[model samples]
Target chain A: MKNLVLASTSTLHGQEYLEYLLPLIKSHFRDCSKILFIPYARPGGISHEDYTATAGKAFEKAGLQVHGIHEFDSPHEAVKQADGFFTGGGNTFLLVQQLYRNDLLPALKEAINKGVAYLGTSAGTNIAGLSMKTTNDMPIVYPPSFNTLGIVPFNINPHYLDPDPASTHKGETRETRIREFHSHNPQPVVGLREGSWLEVKGKNIKLKGDLTARIFEAGKEAFEVEPETLLNDLN
Target chain B: MKNLVLASTSTLHGQEYLEYLLPLIKSHFRDCSKILFIPYARPGGISHEDYTATAGKAFEKAGLQVHGIHEFDSPHEAVKQADGFFTGGGNTFLLVQQLYRNDLLPALKEAINKGVAYLGTSAGTNIAGLSMKTTNDMPIVYPPSFNTLGIVPFNINPHYLDPDPASTHKGETRETRIREFHSHNPQPVVGLREGSWLEVKGKNIKLKGDLTARIFEAGKEAFEVEPETLLNDLN
Candidate 1:
């Protein structure tokens, strides 16, 4: 069975993101020898060996062998040797840049299509969508916004949170910002709040989070759906 | 001369944006009869008629004839009857939605290529770029992110203001948000802060605003440049 789990970030991962995957990781990959980790998304100016190590420790605690792809000469070789792939997120743009520059997106896409279990977080989730246009980050810099791996139809806005009241910054609120996005957009967007994730098993896309993900279509009010809602179920 | 003007939409007219365009509008169309206004971008829940009125009044104060394209049956006809076209701001997604649904982008692009002066502000400026991926608004909805008029190679993030400390509502600060975007992005992005505009005259893309605009390329620090800086001059 082809399985995919996407989270907001490796840093943000905890009971919320892991609860849904821990059982599966143990049950499915119990006899599976190794897991490949892609740590090439270092451009968010925050990627460190310690960060990747921490994430590896999580899987190690779950009884899986984790190997960083950076240790291998080629991503293809790494993928070929692994039972599954775990992609922890940092910045979607940085992740995609590394993926594209090294020509790994197509290879990863091929791996998924070939039935590899794929796990990703924030930036990883953004890459799973049709385009990076829906990311919550500002246009600080531009990567190939049009060069997503095309894993899903709609874009994912991960680490989604409501505007905090204690902070000071003048601009639209998160909801308003999203409303602004919907106001002009002609396509539907999935706003996955923090602690929420989307899991793909076979052809079923299930929402896994505490809050209902917001959906916005052109010329309509943004609406929310319960967790585990299937993408095929959305209009 | 294929002239293009981008305005700042703070007060909607007469002040920052129109002050710069009035003299140019008068000088460029001295022998021409009238200027056309395209006001279909009312998606931000803002007033489109009022926004257009601001431009019309500004042009009238300059002793130039201004007519809204809503008065015409089709944008093509509006283009044929006028010497130039001015697109006022609101929600760019809405404008692009109307343009795409009405199939007006190609028509506008054709008109600009045919030597008609094209002017845009905020959302209007967004359409002139290669894509709206850099816009500061929420991705509330999806228009055709691929259907921009392609007048410029990079995307425009308009109404682009720095984070203000005076208000209280917490998310990422605008600068942080933009930095986050840069962290992920692998391409160059033009961050056009409020009161800033870009002037495209023939092949020259000049920045015009009170403060320097911010530019970001992959894996580099964001740099700022003064007004009228040529696009090619960016390195």
Candidate 2:
């Protein structure tokens, strides 16, 4: 069984880090007091220790203590013993690279499968999908593979933005990029907008937020899945 | 000596393929009658043969003949004997992947060094830089390396977009992505907006177009370079 909060972003516009997610975090980790923070994403090229400190301040509001995975003797052991897990957002490539480098993917997946409370924002949420193929993050570093935890049946594109109708920029839109991904891959994808998240408990996954999430399946017209919709195996 | 026209895009908004660049193309390859087209980028998942034919029609308007590298018995020899070269835009990952798989990087570099007139747009322009690290394209596929021609002293973010002040999207802006790249890399980057290009002749490279190009340097404030600015060894 899985218990996860995969959010589109860590911070929303005009909000502090994880501020909007505090109440949800409190309920998610109500039975636990400590969280193992994986700060490898390093948003803005921040250091792991620095990123962890930032996450710690946010976790404190939820009445929890945070420990960075970097402080442990082994990342695998850190996952094994964590009361809960939280991976913050940053460069997806660097995050995936570090996960492979530390051999933490399998361990983290196993832990989450056993119902360890988990929270993933942005790049963190991306890795919970079938692959990191749909991430909008720049490839600052090349990971050995695009494969991820597959906690969910499909891929996720976080912070998904609608195309600007008035803009003249000719670069492919987010929808175009995801369509291109579909051209080369068979996996379905969910475009998760900011302030939106998917709550997973065992085999049930529900869209939880004020906004509707766009769902993209191969050879099908892309459509929106409304808030609170049960979406597991919908593909 | 090198002769190149690295464009921000193959076709500007509301224009036919290579229409705006035809006059420039005519002048760049004034002495050549035939060109070898490397249609490896495969924009929008287009096929090599189909993309090559499209380039052929565009080159015909400039009074030049187009031959795809795939048509030649030896792509290496085709590069050595090509009167001119044109690499179109598509997925950067696939383009670079094919380039290495076909062993065309060195040959193309050698040809460009020997003063072959060359044209690149979008992903094509990205590879003309020190690396493809600054590309705005998604990672649909993984190439053997991020290394590129390094024909220019810096990296290039083609179809460079400025942050929209009116929007509320939380995804990292293009500027932020480049800044993050600078954190892990020492390479300078040029944000070449649509309708902009770099005109490279031997040791001199000039920014051309009506808009100012944004320049990003490591460990320093990013600035803008005016059109026609001489950029060789500017660092």
Candidate 3:
């Protein structure tokens, strides 16, 4: 029974984001005193030590010890030594690529199943899904499509936005992109706009975001859901 | 071999677009007595008659006979009688939906194999590929993913453009979107800007446009090619 807190970065440091995440981390690891930071995703070309240092500072400011995974030779050792792991957001594609290149997806899945608190943001949020097809970023790089950790059944489209009228360039809107993804895919996708997240506490999965998050199941109308709605079975 | 000219419009009857397509059609089909308009794709939701009229009028002004496929109940027969066929621009997702629903893809493939001469614009251009995954439109509707006529090995991303600087909105750019597509896709995709076209003549596949086209192949740098370089491939 572990609590996972996935968050979009407010800034690079734990100091900036730790306030938002500290309570949740403390609630899960009442006896533990430290949080581990995973920075292997930086090699995917998005995150760097300068970026990760900010994340470390956020946790340190929260009065929690933080360790970078880069210190370990393998993700398994990092996970084993930590009470809970926090995966910060950078580029999900790049993150997954690094995990895949190092053959860590299986180990991460095992850790999650064994009750390692799993937290992610942005691109990290994408890897929680069955596939990364729903991601809104450009696939400027290639990663193993099947390498997702599968903590969540539906795909996560992070940084989702409503259409803006000020823009005149004519093309498909973000909602249209998600709809198109659903049209081609048989799986459900959760379009999580910024400031929104999905929280899993034991067997309970709660939608923690704005007024409503968009949910699209294959061949069905995409509907909005409040925080109280049942989304665990959405996939 | 039959000469094919896929146009962005069918009739250009009353629109200003005729000025752009009329001369091209006349010059390309100078030897042909008639041009067949495939209107079956209209049922997919885009206004068909308007598109047809646009093309029909342009041909008529050039003193060429323009016949709509509706003239015959069976498209197979229409293909047999056609000197060359012009497919107009519309929602390619909808067009392919209709093509799949009516089982017209195989029939059209047969017709093209017989050298009946096929020309498609927009949605029509999409179906001239190995698959339609590269289309820029939203598949708000579901369509069958089946074998296209195979005139090209990759999908055509029509109306492709770089992000407009004058606009203000936060999201992934078109370049990023195409890059995301290539990240997950193993096949190559050709991003064809508006007013640009791919002409397949015999063993030749040439790109015709005012600007460079972006070509994305999985695991390679997305490169740009001038019209001249692409034209060389036509032979």
| DockQ of prediction 1 | 0.19
Among incorrect, acceptable, medium and high, the docking class of model 2 is: medium
On the 0 to 100 scale, the lDDT of residue B167 in model 2 is 69
Better of 2 and 3 by DockQ: 2
- Candidate 2 residues B41-89, lDDT tens each? 7876777899999999998998988899999999988988998999999
Residue-level lDDT tens digits of model 3 in B107-221: 7777676676677776677778766666655333445553466666676676677766764333446666656555446667777766667766665667775768888776678
| Model 2, C-alpha of B182: deviation from truth (Å) | 1.4
Q: Candidate 3 chain A: minimum summed lDDT over ten consecutive residues — where?
A: A7-16
Candidate 3, residue A17: Cα displacement in angstroms equals 8.4
- Per-residue lDDT tens digits for candidate 1, residues B60-112, read 86687778777777766777767788787665656776788777777788878
Q: Give the TM-score of candidate 3.
A: 0.59
Residues A1-235 of candidate 1 have per-residue lDDT tens digits of: 5578776544432343355557656765576676787876543455546556766777776788778887788877777767788776655555666677777777788777677878887767777777775666543333444457666666677766666676333234556655665544444667787667788877788888677887766677777889968885543
List the candidate numbers ranked by TM-score, top first. 2, 1, 3
Evaluate residue B85 in candidate 3 and report its C-alpha lDDT on the 0 to 100 scale. 75
Task: Score every model by TM-score.
Answer: 0.61, 0.96, 0.59
Q: Which candidate model has the greater DockQ, 1 or 2?
A: 2
Model 1 chain B lowest lDDT segment of ten: B8-17
In the range A1-235, model 3's lDDT, one tens digit per residue, is 6366554333222234545556655565555554577775442243456556866776665566667776677666776667667776654556676788777777777777777777777767777888766665433344544347777777777766677776443345666666656545677888776666788776666788454788877778878888666577887
Q: After aligning candidate 1 to the native by TM-score, how far in Å is the CA of B38 from where it should be? A: 4.6
Worst 10 residues of 1 chain A by lDDT: A9-18
